[model samples]
Target: MVDADQTFVIVGGGLAGAKAAETLRAEGFSGRVILICDERDHPYERPPLSKGYLLGKEERDSVFVHEPAWYAQNDVELHLGQTVDRIDRTAKTVRFGDDGTLVHYDKLLLATGAEPRRLDIPGTDLAGVHHLRRLAHAERLKGVLGALGRDNGHIVIAGAGWIGLEVAAAARTYGAEVTVIGTRPTPLHSVLGPELGNVFGELHREHGVRFSFGTRLTEIVGQDGMVLAVRTDDGEEHPAHAVLAAIGAAPRTGLAEASGLEIADRAYGGGIVVDERLRTSDPDIHAAGDVASFPFALFGTRIRVDHWANALNSGPAAARAMLGKEVTYDRVPYFFTDQYDLGMEYSGWAPPGSYDEVVIRGDAGKREFIAFWVKEGRVLAGMNVNVWDVTEPIQNLIRSAAPVDLEALADPHVPLESLVA
Candidate 1:
């Protein structure tokens, strides 16, 4: 059990780390809470970095998890711009990079999160090439693409995932010519399936964003240290003033690996292995957010989710577990995104090839619909696009896990609440 007088250390200053500090204070923990972060800024949310924040609709101050004064007010120590050299797990100390400072902790939480995956194409290091994983990256992109009018600048995005698509929409709103290249035929098809993925693709196409499906980026062409275009495996080159490589992210697990924590099996993306309670192999340490590959009770499998909701929910759960409380972090996975006029909320988990059929309740062509992925008549997952106020019903359907009538589920007249009834 963690004593109130002992020090508690949290690594990484993302949403997970901020929430852990919030929870500790709320739980009346008087221990010294030190938050070590590589970024100089206080903990802030990342979703807006791509959408509203990048588009200039949201202010910088609004994205922060808490004001800078909150940490001081709550007695949480802020260690900004410090790189963690190593975790001396045997000695229960975290060594700093520059000055060799050792911060001792009776209990530790690892929320190092994940880093954006980089493309290894020839000109990836060019000046106009960018990746979006931090505020600094988004700021750089805003400087490059913010003021361009329609067709004034050509922007090539190398991935069709959520980040790529969201930035595409934002760039389009600024009137830039955008082209998205993806190995998959449709954007988000792996998660939402081809039917819904096609909806997103068509939506983008209608707004003048081009697509190069089933192609791989072979090289980023450049001269004078600035990107000029991208060449694909299909022998086609697309002109570009700026390029964004939104090819997804990989869990930052180097600290866990070095500290000898059990790395999750490769099947689970090789993150730090944790139980349902978010406890790592060592009782004195715990990991949450994207770095922890935890056993998900609802899906009956181990998984690591790199979404905003998981980080928001799991951070507090890990804090409670670290306090020696018996708790299970069993909340269903959820995530939401906004691109162009389309807004979507998805709940539950059903990986690609897991669901046998997708049931639609509204007009997909019109962009207002609720889609459900069912396996053996049980609703494994559901998503509502541009459809509001039914998230509770969708979540309830997934939690119940009861077989539903396909005809009724597909009928718009049938209230979602009645399907589970």
Candidate 2:
């Protein structure tokens, strides 16, 4: 029943690809759709891998986005465990792995996401050092941590970012002595600013986690093919059993680059430059998710967000563009982190060292607080710790760019909901 002339080839079978395919079908586009994925399984949810799955709170199947039957029912041709080698724009074909399979398409989308960054330092290749990026990685880490048996074993996290901090909390809960070594002066200081970042740092410290702040990990020492200690830039060594390198992620643009797509220079700053509609340098090809650096309306610049909100939203937006109904991707960037019975939610985006003011609502010492970063009286970004419900209102304030009265914003008596309207 689908049109032959309307074939769509989407590369990368993660959230973006899966969601885009579903969105296209939901939009009543009866076209030949082929999804090419490097992984040999159904598209799965990745967020839970760090918390629920890693902690054995959830099953493996619970993390998947779609089941086998759902793909068959929707008429989505899924080519899993296959790698797309390169794209031929002139011939409108994509050459894939081993069998050298080539798929032709009228429209192409590159949702090629990012991979976990590893520590280039020595002993990183040790048997006990792990990076949690996939389900298998989480399962292996859980196995290793469980085998350590709640003793004097230490888990060294190389970064203080969300992933690293989340794992640190998880490691502590699992009865492992967790030591966090962050390059920043404070935990998440780059994103939350020094003020709020210090609050998070204090929270972790109060929970009995050791933090080596403003220290660079130069080398990881190993014993018997396993991590034993991490050497810092300050020339000090910290003892450890397991090492988790969660520094950050790099955009997996190898395929794109091989296909001759213009690679944006991230050194001078800014991510991959896609337009408002998420089109890459080649108009025939498109990209979304962590790999695609698209313009955000709230932030007023091109950003590559490694968050669930952006991954889910950008896919559908790219699908609209493929269908000729272009929509600007201008949503307020939002993210949350759950660690040791505490929930932290962040809304919108603000440049580092750029906020004019930070107004706190609630008690930072109690770890139940809302901090708003105001630039020119407008709420550019904000973070809510133990205040999950504040996310909506604060996000609305960011979207509206509404001026917040300092006194009212700082008052706990004035509901955050009052700011939205």
Candidate 3:
């Protein structure tokens, strides 16, 4: 039933869109495939931007999802530096670029990703103000960090979330003065809750990262269009040669909205609403990655995950589904982070207030431990810090949904596999 005459079009050129193109060909679909990207650069991964690439540990070319030649080799037509601004759902056609080149698609995939939330304060247009969502931004910030390190300059970050903390670690490693500001009592309070989040706060403190918790940025005080310092709502000002707005990101769904697609509200992570098969309200159109809010049967909720793991897996799942294969995307949510000497892998979802108790196994002080969020004795989520080879067992325990012994769960001597029935 593979129609060689039909054309499949994918929007957004990030990891998800790229993987979808690869999957289409792998499924033996002898059809025309077109991939459109707004970014001029080839589709690349975003993690290294705040991790190794920013830290000078990784090369520039290592971030791309595939070699420049892969698209042509796989017969995947790539349209870079262009955008599909309008989609005529009635006609099943998309218009792109200034010329409004129209392309008819038998099935369309929208992998449009999210963008960093802009700082609401004044002086954000200053030269030294930066956000690390795109490669161009990271390339600029990398040099800024090196210059700050050489001159012993200071940087005041506006948020204590993942991007803020990761950038702070890189800044300190580069020998720049660092201070982090957050509205939460502890970092990652929304995701990890206060008990475990305090661990990260203390780790950053030990590494010379100053914290101004329970507050937010008020204004970026600058002179001559260059950031000089930042003022907080608490009436305190910190000298800052540079300022990073690590607030958060919002899903890019203007195209979906313009096309009158069903977009979920902020409560559901604000993305295109997709079914278990990754099909949107319009049956012929699909969504994935940070832009797809789908039904997660295991979590009993329609959730949207804005992380690397979701894009890496959901893209192919959606691709196979688009190819007329039955697909139920119930893969356990997974994500990892590396800051300084601590490397952690987190699986499953346990939003704050959703879990009753958090059990710790191994030595937390040494950063070699696994923390489980449990509700009524059922494992809800697990995060392993400086631990290895435990993701499978952690995910298995969550999937089993069997109540576990609190004492055994907290004991390092017990094997995680034995507890899952």
Candidate 4:
């Protein structure tokens, strides 16, 4: 029931929102479009904020997905420095926090992404305790490094996720003293299994970075309103001038919940529920990117993946659904993380506790290898650490769902292509 010239309102100007705007225009839908973003800057790359941006290797404009001129040229109206206070579902309107401007939309897209989780302990609000999610956060952290010379600067990262490790690597590049603490037994254990995780643990240890595993941070000790120490669960404390909480992020869905939408328990983690075609409970609304937990047809389950690949692919899927085209947003989930000059790629979908066998095909000790997760003789997922080219064959195997020879996969002499059939 939408008018030909109706407006399309996209919430959250991250990758999903910005790309969705571009895709809509490419699809020949020249309707009025508006993008809402709270951040002062336009859409930029988030991954580099944890790596190159922190290391001062890339400029601010380099991180942007597209320049402002691109938006103007495409006739996309951008509402930067604007916050969407509420969503009026009955009226199909979005209210802005400043001046309370209400925008009416014939169709809506929820692309509000995630924010870095914060710690609730005392002294967490201190000046030196930070979370690296936005450009402002990266700029502030980089400034902290600039003031304190790399040799004596101490960084305490509270979580063992990708952000924590990526930042640790960047800090180490500058010869800073880095200490990574995690609640788990091994760093990267949640994603990579125990065996491979032990290798990652050893690799970090080889560098001068101290890894504190199986410990919980109790409090942040500060002096003159700035962080000075990080206290642990075991009554141990470490000197720290800077502290970062890179513990995972949760979906930002306050707007959808306030609009009387059906939210799930995993909503905070996986995000709003949608079908294979990415349609929400209300057919008039569609969601994509990190904010939508659409069913995974390949795994026959629901999973929320926060990665560049997922962000790129999900927008097209949602756009197809918006065009009333029948489509399924099901594909093997993929992601990667960069740490200490290492390029790690993870692909395909794996069920919980589903892998009965894992084949390692290279020297894991040298930081170059590929591990295959196989369940019931079927290749489910593959991970490569510094072994970039092998991923192509593994991806083919996943798509074909072919049976693998365990012995062949474990042989370093045999090429990965041998198992492609």
Candidate 5:
């Protein structure tokens, strides 16, 4: 039984924090709910930041999780633009940066999220260099992209992950010369494997995007304190009006560390360690979203997923756990990405070097396919590219863990449901 009068303080005002607050209210917890956000805006979805929002296809209001009126209606307190300085577990209080207000909580949820990884290379502090982790960053980059539409601008993107690739597509759509620099031989090689990665590389190449693969960015050259060009280890200088560093993101766990919560080691991506129920070492404190590295029952390993779906689902799971409800965060991990005309939806966990074989079901050249990663004759993970309305079957196959007929799985004529049946 939850103490209805106890206060619940949720840190980090991203999708996870918003969803947790919603869950608490939906679960009939008439308690004091306070959401602390470092950003000025309320919680909003981030997927559109790189795609629709950057491309000017979507409006600003559509990205928000809830309008201002929803908070007032639900009786949820919003403390925006306030950074949590420290967490004193002994006092059950969290110190804020703005005016140094110390707020107490009977239960706390840390959704501090992650920050964009910054490069130590030269000229990174220059005016036109950008990193897109927040809406503010996206807004700044959107301005640069707008300039590209009017002028003959060149954008040099560092790293070949999802953000870098999506931005490359968006910049190309706006008639900018895009150059992507990556350490891997192919973009997203580690996650999607080289075969599927080459397909994306081909997609970008078709749109006139250049790739300097298997190279490192040594410096970002600037003129008048604004980005002008980038120097790669291959001794080549690529001229650019803007630079985007999308190498990766590091989990924001300083408060969790200061409060003596158990954190995963570097091997597990250095996030807050949580159990199946999303409870940290201290039962009073819980974690969710990108910050929580919890045990994944299906994969038999601890993993932290940094994607929209995880943040959306884990928030409620953590909230339920906090209320002493019997729950298990066992949802299959899912993520999706859109680039140019290509859209992909992937589900289940197939960690690098874990899958034994990959079976493709459609033509990679046509950019329509479903790829499955199998281990020990069981379907571990599956990805559908440019295919719609089949995620349910793919997820069902993964959950069943049944041995599949390779011929039937590869045949487009066979309905995915029949294979599982």
Candidate 6:
């Protein structure tokens, strides 16, 4: 039974951490709930950092998980700008980094999230170099893009993953010249494979975004502590006013590591290892969001996804489990992207080389289609581009794991639900 004496402390106040606190209260927990964040801003969603907020399509307040007043209204103890340096599993307490303040917990949830992978090359400390993993970063980039647009400046991006392409689209929208550098041959090559990856590459190119595929940034040449240009591995120099390191993000696992939490393999997201119920090595401590790598029953492997949907659903799942409810977080991996006129949703996992082939159900040339990654006559994953209301059937097909007729799968006339049946 929960009581006024009981306390639940949540670390890392991103969408996952904020949602977990909300879920705890919704599930009728009257205990003291403390939500802590390293960032000064209130808990906010990450997608808008690259898509809407940076594009000037969304306002500053639109990205928060809850209004500044919601925490007070809900009686949730909100702690911002405080970093939890050490988690003492034995003492059941977390110590603050700045002031060394201690907070005890009956149960603790770590939703530490992820940090953008930094470019290892020199001049990263230059004034114009930026990373987009936080609200402050996006806010800075938004202003930089506006200034670049006004000054007719060029921005060189150091990766062609989702963040790179999304930032490219936003930069182009602001009339700034964008040059994208990637080690892979196509944009999003690791996620969508070559064929569909080509589509995104072409999309950016059509919007006047330059691609330096198969190459990566080697150095950020700067002057007076400001960026001047970037040099690539191929001995080509591209002049730039700003540089964005969109390589990807790594899970923030330092606190977990220091606390001696079991960590997963580096190749598989390198996050804190958690069981099916989101319980860590210590039963009193649980994990969620990008930091927790839990066993995925559907894939029969442990996968840690850094998508917004994972943070959206996993937080509540961990909260429910913390409240002594049975929870199996087997939600199908889901992610979406909106670039220019194209909006796409991808479900299930189909890493590179894992699928036999990718089949497209509609006209890819028309910028509309459903791409399925098939493995041994079974649909391993599906991506619907500019399609509507098909997420349910697509997720159902993935869970079914039944052999499907490849021909019927590619036919636009065939109903996806029928194939699942």
Off by over 4 Å in 2: 267-271
lDDT (tens digit, per residue) of candidate 4 on 79-184: 8989998988889899999999999987888888887788878889888888988889999988876555445779899988788888888777777788999998
Clashes of 1: 1
Q: Candidate 2 on 50-132: residue-level lDDT in tens?
A: 88888889998998878878887988989888998878999999998768888898889898888988788788788888898
Kindly provide the TM-score of model 1 when superposed on the true structure, using C-alpha atoms.
0.97
TM per model?
A: 0.97, 0.95, 0.98, 0.94, 0.97, 0.98
Task: Give the alpha carbon lDDT tens digit for every residue of 196-224 in model 5.
Answer: 78889999999999999999899999878
Candidate 2 has a TM-score of 0.95
Global CA lDDT of candidate 2, please? 0.83
* Backbone Cα, N, C clashes tallied per candidate: 1, 0, 0, 0, 0, 0
Q: What is the lDDT of residue 312 in candidate 6?
A: 97
Candidate 1 has its poorest 10 consecutive residues by lDDT at 142-151
lDDT of 1 by residue, 1-421 (tens): 3345799999999999999999998988878899999999889999998999999899989999998899999989889998887999889999988799999999999999999998986988898888999999988888778645544989999999999999999999888999999999889867787868998999999999999999989999899998889999999999998899999899999988998999888677768888888989998999989888988766778888889988999999999988888888877788999988899999888878888989999998888999999999989999999999998899899888889999999998999999884
- Backbone clash pairs in model 6 (N, Cα, C under 3 Å; residues 3+ apart or in different chains), count: 0
Report the C-alpha lDDT of model 3 over 1-421, residue by residue, as the tens digit. 3355989999999999999999999989889899999999999999999999999999999999999999998888999999988999999999996688999999999999999999887899998999989999999999999999999999998888889989999999998999999999999888899989989998999999899999999999989889999999999999999999998889999999999999998997899999988999999999999999988777788888989999999999989999999999888999989999999999999999899999999999999999999999999999999999999999999999989999999999999999998
Alpha carbon deviation, residue 131, candidate 4 (Å): 0.5
Worst 10 residues of 4 by lDDT: 261-270
Clashing pairs in 3: none
Residue 92 of model 4: what lDDT? 87
Which pairs clash in the backbone of model 4? none
Candidate 6 per-residue lDDT over residues 93-124, each given as its tens digit: 99999999999999999999999898998889
Question: How close to the true structure is residue 131 of candidate 5, measured as C-alpha lDDT?
Answer: 95
